[model samples]
Target: MSLNFNKAEFTRSAAARSGFLRDGRPQFAFAGRSNVGKSSVINRLLGRKNLAYVGASPGKTTQINYFLVDQQAYLVDLPGYGYAKVSKAEKDRWGRLMESYFQDEGGLITTGVLIVDIRHKPTADDVTMHNWFRESGCPEIVVANKLDKLKRSQVEPALELIRQTLELREEDRLVPFSAEKGAGKEELIRLLCEACGQ
Candidate 1:
């Protein structure tokens, strides 16, 4: 049977490694910089307005949050990176937390979704996060989010720039998306289903 992502529900948030879920369910993690609309994308994917908490302040999400989809798989929301307001000590803590999660021996993550702003060139932090996903040996899907903010003619060029900047391979999936307007939501849901083996 196919999984129903519409049934996704907030499970828990883990600030430390000890708090992470360990039930052996397939996990698809979302990673991106602060203000990249990662939370908005997740909420849109789940068909909820605020399931992932669209914070007004950038870098408000400081924990690894887990949302269960139909009780079949897990949607992991990693902390947003690259916000300058945070202190160096806090940044170091975030780094350690992310490293431990990725380096986990439990094989929790099956795939990664890296979100970036569609209008701007990929930032240095974006490249670093992309490389981390690649180095983790997990298949990744890049989403150039906030697509509705661009002109129709600018879409292709913007996507191409993201593809080139991220150094995405030909086979890698780079989806142009808009959480507000629901653009590319189906494609993303299909990818999530595939990641969960649904």
Candidate 2:
């Protein structure tokens, strides 16, 4: 049976590795910089409002949220990284928690979705995440979000910058997305469905 993207439910939030789901389900982990609209992208893909908790002030939430989609696969929301205003200690803690998740022997992430703002160059943290996902040997894709903010002629250059900045190979997928206007939703859904083997 095909996976139903609409039949999603909030499963739990994992503040630490202990709280992570280990039921052997394939996990589609979405990651991004703080304020990159990671939640918005997830919500858009799911065709739901507020399913992933779009924060007014982004980067405050520091937990991994697991959402069960169609009782078949898991959409894991990793904490947004590389935002200012957070304390040094909190950042360290977040770092450790994220490291643990990546280093996990059970292979917690089946597919990695890395979201970046299309208007700016990818940050160091973003590069680190891309490397982490690559090193983990999981199927991954880079989503250039906020596509609506760019002009018609600026899109290609922006995407190329992201691709070059991330050192993405030709086989790596880079999707231009706009969470607000629902552009690129179908492509993202197709990737997710493929990841779940639906």
Q: Which candidate number would show the highest lDDT if scored against the true structure?
A: 1
Instruction: Give the whole-model CA lDDT for all candidates, comma-separated.
Output: 0.90, 0.90
Task: Give the residue spans of candidate 2 off by over 4 A.
Answer: none
Residues 131-172 of candidate 2 have per-residue lDDT tens digits of 999999898989999999999899999999998999999999
- Provide TM-scores for the models: 0.96, 0.96
Judge candidate 2 against the unseen true structure and give its global Cα lDDT, from 0 to 1: 0.90
Deviation (Å) of 42 in candidate 1: 0.7
Model 1 residue pairs with clashes = none
Query: On residues 39-109, what C-alpha lDDT tens digit does candidate 1 reach at each position?
Result: 99999989999999888888988889999999988899999998738899998898999999998888668
